[model samples]
Target chain A: MLILHCPHCDRMVDETDLHPGGEAHLKRHGPEADAEAFENYLFMRENPKGVHFERWRHVYGCGKWFLAARNTATLEVYGTYPAQTHQPPQTIRDTITERQPGWAWGDFR
Target chain B: MSEPVSALRGRATSGSVQVSDMGLQGMISLRCDLSFGKLKALSKDLVGAPVPALREAQVRNDRAALWMSPDELLFLMPHTEVDDALSRIAKAMKDQHHLALDVSDARALLRVEGPFAREVIAKLAPVDLHPDVFGPGQVLRTRLGQIAAAFWMTDAQTFQVICFRSVAHYAFDLLEASAKAGPVGHFPRGT
Candidate 1:
């Protein structure tokens, strides 16, 4: 039931209007990578209770994919940005830090 | 060389509003960076209207340019003018990275007219249809019940909805049902 802003369309859209695309910012393991690395890349996921980053498609709106940073525990959406971005913008990380203090996710702080 | 027929063959429905198939309309799917300088000029030359701003439509008389996405626009004109429009676009943007195609036959256009037009569409799409929030010149690509559709206001009391021709009958029936479902009074009648 979350109403999230779509960075591409600049519209606040209903959750029903969006399609969740699982976790974001996963590193890829190519054909040369070890079995363990490939398995982790394919199936391993972080289930952090706070400050989760995920992909979402504006399936009903602009039909573009975007990334969202939100607090899973409180349903507070920190921000959303275009899918082309490799990392959450500095401002969103700063916002998360201001609330959670010293919080970091994988390689992003 | 052969006769072109619209989906549903120009069906019309009456309830609180007038819903009818707008018949075959010429639509061109143009995908390119909107900021390309020549795009604005060439589109104006082809459609008699400037390329629309985000979520807006640039329209003049029987022609309109509707913003479909960050890098896409759907141009509308008379059905007979499609081939010429495609050629003009090809010639104008030949040197640029662009994709232009005639989509006139791939979709159906429906018109809903009456004071309750907004409410009728609102009953289906998740868009906020308040007059101030959505009115003439604003185009929205959104879901209509179970289908993907785009719609825009031609005037305060008129709306034009475009959906895939494969779903034309379903879209028309949805609009008709919404129109007959009786107003929820979410928006005042005749506003």
Candidate 2:
């Protein structure tokens, strides 16, 4: 069982007590965007083999949604932060960079 | 507008632990930023206590306030006082971005007591029930079986559980079953 620290409740929550909300940081394309852009926004998702950012809900605890940076291969969680953040905080990025050197995703390097 | 009745009709069961319906309890769901000065002031008047810190519960006399989330609190009192409490909250929080409502009838309250009360709760919830981990002043919102529930220790050997009224029977059955299964001897007797 994967245990993750929920930033909202500040508790190490069990995986069974949380709900996975797929990928995080999906930029939505409004109606003004082209078909391809909207399609990418709706369907395209990152399934990286290494570090991944995902959304999770502490459904059984504080009932707040938060983001997590995790290593898909090793199941190592780098950090968790509130969903209100636009992107992972610098601390989490630094932690990930230290562990997985030369890691880059989208516009973030 | 009719008489208020508990979901379990005040039924109780005895096994290794005592499980009983706590009857109608006045509960108000107040959702607002906890840092708001007005909320701190209104809560003092509304519940006779300050807003509890995160995951904490403060009980004084017959009134109590428990933190449900960072921005939500549940206030408890006598069943007959729900309307008055809601009105007071409404009047105090007008022109503010807040949500306060009478949720007493929407949920069921159960009490679990006995030497093995902590074990019974541990069998279902994912939370740590050790005295050092979850003592008197802490409250947790978690799942009991397949239903959503919240629980807190009234003391070392007594626990109060809250779940939706619609599933009161299920919750009672779950608690009864857990109690009937007997203590696992996982937790030592006495603190």
Candidate 3:
């Protein structure tokens, strides 16, 4: 079973205890945005093979939503952080950079 | 309101494992920033003890507060004491971004005791029930046989499992089946 470190509970919980919430840090598109922007916000997602950022909920644990930075291919986890921030913490981005050189995700490169 | 009847009635126990409905107990879902000094003081005053930290529980007399999350606590007391507890908590948290709801009737409490208590629970729960890892005062929010449940180890041989009242019977059945199945070999340390 996949184990994920839940930042909220400060515990490494089993994957069965968590609920995957798809991609993380997506900018919301309101009525003011163009059709293309709205469609991208709703339907478009980055299914990259390398470094990726995603959202997960410790549903059966702390019941808090958190973000995880990991490599989709190698399953190497960079870090997990609270989901309150709109962007990943700089420390997490730096860790990803150190592990997977030249890797970029969203606004962090 | 009519007197609430237990979901399991008289059929909860099986073999060495005794699963009995705790009946109607006062339950309050409290949410607030515990880091706030005022809130922390208010919680101690309301629960008659300091609020529990993560994955921990603080017991004061007949009442106990279990930490459900960073910002949430589940307060347990006698059913008769719910009104007084809620009013006190609400007044103290007034104007704050806090929530205090009386969930006494919405849930059911099952007391599991005896030697095989942990083993029975381990059959259906994914949690590590090893005594060294999960001992007294520890609480966990998890699923038992497809039903959402929260439980706390009251002692080495006793666990109080709380689940939604709607699924009380279903939960009891699952617990009984697992209890009768006896201990499994999956747990390395054994209960």
- Name the candidate that leads on lDDT: 1
Residue B21 error, candidate 1, Å: 0.3
Question: Per-residue alpha-carbon lDDT of model 3 for B157-182, expressed as tens digits?
Answer: 77889999899999988987887777
For candidate 1, write residues B1-191 as lDDT tens digits.
Answer: 88999997989987669899999899999999889889988888878887899899877778899999998999999999999989899988988999999999999999999888889999999878888788888898888999989999888888999999999999999999999886788887775
Q: What are the candidates' interface root-mean-square deviations?
A: 1.1, 0.9, 1.1
Give the clashing pairs for model 2. Answer: none
| Candidate 3: CAPRI quality band | medium
- Native-referenced Cα lDDT, model 2: 0.89
Chain A, model 2: TM? 0.96
The candidate with the higher DockQ, 1 or 2, is: 2
True contacts kept of 2: 0.73
TM-score of model 1 relative to the true fold?
0.96
**CAPRI verdict (incorrect, acceptable, medium, high) for model 2:** medium
Per-prediction DockQ, in order?
A: 0.71, 0.80, 0.73
Which residue runs of candidate 1 sit more than 4 Å off their true CA positions?
none
Ten-residue stretch with the least lDDT total in model 1 chain B: B182-191
lDDT of 3: 0.83
* Fnat of model 3, as a fraction: 0.67
TM per candidate comes to 0.96, 0.96, 0.91
Worst 10 residues of 1 chain A by lDDT: A8-17
Overlapping backbone residue pairs in candidate 1 total 0
